[model samples]
Target: MGYALTFEGLRDLAEGAAVLGTGGGGDPYIGRLLVEQQLKAGRTVTIIDAAELPDDALVIPSAMMGAPTVFIEKLPSGAGNIAALRALEAHLGRTAAATMPIECGGLNSMMPLLLGAQLGLPVVDADGMGRAFPELQMETFAVYGVSGSPMAIASDHGDTGIINATDNRRMEWLARAMTIQMGGASYISDYPMDAATVRRTAVPGTLTLARRLGAALRQARAEHADPFQALAAALSGTLYTHGLVLFRGKVTDVDRKTVDGFARGHVTLADLADPRDQLEITFQNEHLVARRNGRVVAIVPDLICTLNSETGTPVTTEALSYGQRLTVFAISTPDLMRTPDALDCFGPTAFGLADPYTPVEHLTAVP
Candidate 1:
C-alpha cells in the first residue's frame, strides 16, 4: 500500500532524510517548504513501494546537482525539475511509468517526490543511495552498471540541455560541466532503467524508511521519551542497522570552505560530560569520516550523523555551528556498498583518504 504525502507527513520524511543524509544532502527544511508549496497548490504525491512496480515498468531516477549551499543564495527555478524529466522522457522515447530518488538524503530525496506530485506520477519507495553521497558516479545505479545518460539538465531561466554519455563516469563529468555553465545548482534526470534493473540496483524502501524514521522521532518528542533511543530503534534493521551513539557534546570548532563546487569542512565536538572525549567529523557535502578520541571510528558507506542533543533536529554541514550541543551517531551501510567493486568506487580511498575501510560494526564492537 502507498501513503499520500502531506505537510504533516513531511516532518517525518524530513527528519528521516536528515538521518539518511548523514550530514550532507542539503537542508531538508528547504526541500519540505518547496514541496509543501506544491501540496498546498493541490498536487498530491503518493509514495509507492518498489515491490508494487511491474517488472516491465519504465522508471526514471532524478536528483539535484551542484552545491547545496548555492540553493540557499539562489532558489531553484522549480520548473527545472519536470523540464529535465520531460526532456529525458523525450530522449528515451518513453514516458516514465514512475520516478524515484537518486538518493534518500537531503534535497534530492524530496526532488523526485516533488516531480512526482507535480507530474501526477507515483514515486518509487526506493533510491540509489540508502544514504546521501556528494558525487553522481557513486550511486548504486552507477556501481551496478547502469548508464548515466542520455541525461538532461534544466534551469528555471528556461535553459535546458540534453546529454548522452557512453558511461556513468563520463555522464557525471559532462553534467558537472553543464551544471557550472548553467548555474551552480540545477535539476538532473538520468539512469533511466526498467523495474527489473531498478530492483537489483536501487536501495529499496529507503523513501518509506525515511518517512517512518522521521515519524519515529516526531512521536518520541511528542511522548517525552529519549529521541536518541527512538532514533536508534527506528533504524534497528535497515542497512544502517549497526546504530551507535558515538558521543554527545558541544561543538568547539568548525573549519569549512567551498571547493570544486562542494562544501568541504570539519566539525569538532567536545564531550559534554568530559571535554577530553571528543569527536571530529570531516565532510565533503556528506560526512565522510568520524574520529572519536583521536581514533578513527566511522568511515564512509556507513552513516555518520549529528543531531541536536536535546531536540534531535539534524544539523547540516552548512548549518553547523561551534556552540550547538549535539549527539553524533553511526550506522552500518548496506551490504551492496561493501562489495569490492562498490568499495573501489565509493570507499575511503575514492574520497582520497588512506585508511583501509572498516565497517562500523567492527569499530563499535563490544569487547
Candidate 2:
C-alpha cells in the first residue's frame, strides 16, 4: 500500500523531521515546497515497504548535497534533483526498481516524493538515518558497509559526473568539489544496495513514522492541544525548552562565504524587545551554534529549531536573517542518536566547536 504526500501532510512531517534533525538536517521547508508544488500539479507520490522490494531490485537513494544556503539562491534547475537518478542508471546499466530517502529530515524526505512522481517509481517507506546529521557517512549505509561511491551527481547546468571513490569519505570529498564547481547545488544518486542490504541497515518504517508524526501533530492542533506535546508522545521523544520571541527583525547583516565546499555564515539578529540587544547565529550548512545574552544555550545533536512566534513553523538555518521574530526550542535527540557511533558523527566536535558534547537533558532540564 502507498500514501500520497500532501502539503498538510508535510507540515507535521516536516516538523517531526526537523525535531529529529539534531541540529543538522537542512530545512524541511525546501523539500516541502518541492514536493507540495509537484503534488498540486496532479503528480502523485507512493511509498512502499522495503520488504516488498525484490532481491535483485536496484535501489538508489537520491538527495541534494552542499550548502543549504546555496540551494535557495541556486535552486535546482532542469529538474536537478532527478538528474542523479538518470546518471545512476547510466552508470549501472539498469533501471532502478525503487528510490528511497537516504535520511528522513528536511530536503531528504520530500525529494524522494518529487522524484518518484516524476519517474513513476515507488518510494520505499524506510530511510537510513531515523534523524538528520551532517555527513553522508552518518547513515545506516555506514553500518551496512554500503559505499556511497560509484555514485552519480548532476546540476541544473546539465552537467553530470559519476564518482567511483574508494569509500564514502572520498565520495564526500569528490561530491563537495563537484557541487562547488556547479555553483553550490548538485543532486546525487548513491548507495546502490539490494533489498536484503536495505532491510538490514535502515530504520524500518521510517517513512510511515514520518507520516504518522505529521498526522498526529495536525490532529492535535485541530483539537486545540499542544502540538509539540503530541509530537513527543508519538516519537517517544522528550520536549526540552521553549522560549519567547527575542527578536522580530529583518536580515540586516549576513556574512556568508564558501570555504572548502562548505557554506559558512553568521546572521546578526536584532532584538525587537531591546534594539541594543543583538543576537548572532553561526552556521555551517546547518545550524551549528546559537548565542543569546552572552550565553550558549544550544549546540549540536540536540535539535535547535527556530519557529515563527505567530505561526509556529520551522525556519531553516539557511533562511535565518537579521530581523525575523522567532522563538527557539530545544528538542532532545532520540535514543538512536545517542549511540556511540551516531554521537561521534554529529557531536560537538563534528561542528568544530570546542566544548565536549553534552547530553541535551542537562541543557533542557525540566524544573
Scored against the true structure, residue 68 in model 1 reaches a CA lDDT of 76
Clashing pairs in 1: 25-106
Per lDDT, the best of the predicted structures is 1
Model 1 quality (TM-score): 0.97
> After TM-score superposition, what is the CA distance of residue 131 in candidate 1 from its true location, in Å?
0.5
**Maximum-TM-score candidate:** 1
lDDT of 1 by residue, 118-188 (tens): 89989998888889998888888888988878889897787888888877778888888888777778888
lDDT of each: 0.86, 0.69
Relative to the unseen true structure, what is the C-alpha lDDT of residue 308 in candidate 2, on a scale of 0 to 100?
53
User: 110-185, model 2: which lDDT tens digit per residue?
Assistant: 7777789888888988777765665677676775578887798988877889999988777877888888888876
CA lDDT of 149 in candidate 1?
A: 82
Instruction: Mark the 10 consecutive residues where model 1 has the least summed lDDT.
Output: 235-244
